[model samples]
Target: MATPMLTSPLTPRLTRRQLMRSALAGSTAFAVMPRPGAQGLTGPAYEVSAWTGPVSGFALVDTTGKTWRPADLRGRAVLLNFWASWCEPCRAEMPTLQQVADLYGPDKLLVLAINFKEPAARAIQFAKTTGVTMPVLLDVDGRAARQWGVKVFPTTLTIDSRGRPRQRVQGEVDWTSSAADKLITGLIQA
Candidate 1:
């Protein structure tokens, strides 16, 4: 008897332009900023760029088994932080994110820590251990990250109250800093 083979599910193929764009997005994920005075901002060790690609909507369940969707969060600015427990930068910046979440309150700003390809248990445990109180959504299959074009760890996408993507910040920065305040303030005021 011959051995049987298993086939995987069919998925859409990417075009040449899409491939190149993914390559470019990954390559330039980390944009270095010039020293303080040049940009007139000080001590923000991260890059901010306009959001690209389409992120019309997403539905992901959090550790508490609550399904969160963009539609449910209308009339509020959202900070979607793509992260994993293993990433050092992600871990380092989480506390500040928590503080920002606390300061802003859910009515105005909703900070969601979307755990990339991590189990719900791990995400919950990490949140408990780190004292991070924000909602931690699980992206177990990594489809959300790919959909959002987040090729880098610790990438943050800011969505305005009107549900438009405003900016994508790659890398870590002290979220409690003045620069971060300005950024978040703008989003809240939007």
Candidate 2:
């Protein structure tokens, strides 16, 4: 017998607009706030809301057995990517994410791949097969995801250098794209 997976009825329903946005593979989505000093820029590749939650702290362990928290990552822009091994879109955008991580380096930016409710072996194997060198954190109980208000797979939270939550992207994004580069560059420079 298998245990039944349950979901909260209070989980916020996704709007049709959101469904459309997430439908586009490798599309970037975030709040439509005008980036300061970014004049004549086009809209985001997709659309979603900004992060409006506490930026206080969180704790999760990486595949290498190291525990991490926000305090441990201050003075650097952090991209907390919530994903699961079975999610196709999540797997698809990973290489581009690695590219972004390598482009910025560990000092300027840290991209943590937070695997949702999966075993450590699974994430490790996926990282090994995919050659993702970034820190792959495990949310084995899904607590970190819930705390971060991630109701969707492949959601990414961007934290600026000052440890401020900047954007909440709720879908797959081609991190190598110009739009992604601009957003990440702004975070690094902020």
Q: Which of the numbered candidates is closest to the native, going by highest TM-score?
A: 1
TM-score for each candidate, following the candidate numbering: 0.78, 0.77
Candidate 2 segments exceeding 4 Å error? 1-46
Q: Give a tens-digit lDDT track for model 1, residues 29-100.
A: 445442324533334445678885465667899999999876777898889999999988799899999999
Error of 2 at 59 (Å): 1.3
Worst lDDT window (10 residues) for model 1? 3-12
Count clashing residue pairs per candidate. 0, 0
- lDDT per residue (tens digit) for residues 15-99 in model 2: 3444455454333443442222334322333345567557666788999999997687799998889999898868988999999
Alpha carbon RMSD to native, model 1: 12.5
Cα lDDT, model 1, residue 71: 76
- Inter-residue clash pairs, candidate 1: none
